[model samples]
Target: MTVPVADDWRPRLSPGLVLRHDRARETDVLLMPERIVVLHGQASTVLELCDGTRTVPDIVAVLAARFPRAPVGDDVGVFLERTRKEGWTR
Candidate 1:
């Protein structure tokens, strides 16, 4: 089987915000009352970074610099994987 690249499964983005919708988390699911408040910080930042110019690695790099306390390389990789699978990129 072929290996997957970090940006492999995600859709293409033109511009603007890309929202993350989670099925299990009612807060992240659209129309839910909580409305992603629990993930208001990092997760939102992750989603917003999916611009055309920034690859998955670039996104991680920028966030890493911005948030020294946050997990960078592997963490952003995982989050991007999930976001890609969930069709959040496009």
Candidate 2:
């Protein structure tokens, strides 16, 4: 069953998955078995905070502080939910 991502959910990279920066590409990539998901925009920033500690609100707060005018709450929430559904995060 698919579980909806909650506001209190603490996200982290799934097992066996690694996030790294590809020097040649100059961007962050999610490394998994036989697959490389290239990250874009603030994706790397968002994923870095997914250390299995901070809740969704905390993540939003951090981003909001960095980009005070941006709608980080909704953006972060949607991004997290999508990543969760994609099995990249837990």
Candidate 3:
């Protein structure tokens, strides 16, 4: 799968953490260091896939099934980079 990553950073899920979202309330799954990372629709979908067990590509593949419109390749690279840089995942 592709991560739809951008930027130059990569993110990982902290061992003690899990992504939990409240769609009805619009709450987001936030990572440490950074707080209140409100996921916006598809971005949330991507972040949810950052389980650390999967590689960047794995995320993209999973997401591709849902968001066929997402940009692949470099696009995923950018997303990974930005998320990591923000210190969101791990």
Candidate 4:
């Protein structure tokens, strides 16, 4: 799959997948066909914003505002690329 560029890319979590937050374990997980992806904190935040309506840049902006101390764009971009490769987003 081609990695989506940040500008015109509107990302949505893959269909048939469910994001579950485990409070007791303090973890986030993605459930998909025969697969489970454990998500770290920043990954959870970024994926929550991938609602099919927001471009990558838009996501970066929101994250930037919410986390004024961290530079998150590059990390988000890398994560999105990995997700795209793994067929976790569209």
Q: Could you arrange the candidates by TM-score from highest to lowest? A: 2, 4, 3, 1
How many clashing residue pairs appear in each of the predictions shown? 1, 0, 18, 0
Error of 3 at 61 (Å): 1.3
User: Cα deviation of 7 in candidate 1 (Å)?
Assistant: 6.6
Among the numbered candidates, top lDDT falls to 2
* Candidate 4 minimal-lDDT segment of 10 residues: 1-10
Give the whole-model CA lDDT for all candidates, comma-separated.
0.58, 0.90, 0.62, 0.85
Query: Candidate 3, which segments miss by more than 4 Å at Cα?
Result: 1-11, 15-18, 22-34
Error of 2 at 77 (Å): 0.6
lDDT of 1 by residue, 16-48 (tens): 333556667744421223333345447767766
Across 36-70, the per-residue lDDT of candidate 3 in tens digits comes to 45566567667767766677767667777777776
TM-score, one value per model: 0.58, 0.92, 0.63, 0.88
Please write out the lDDT profile of model 4 over residues 1-90, one tens digit for every residue: 334476989989989988889776779988898887889868888989989999999998999999988768667787888888889998
Q: Clashing residue pairs in candidate 1, if any?
A: 27-36
For residue 56, model 2's alpha carbon misses the true position, in angstroms, by 0.4
TM-score of 3: 0.63
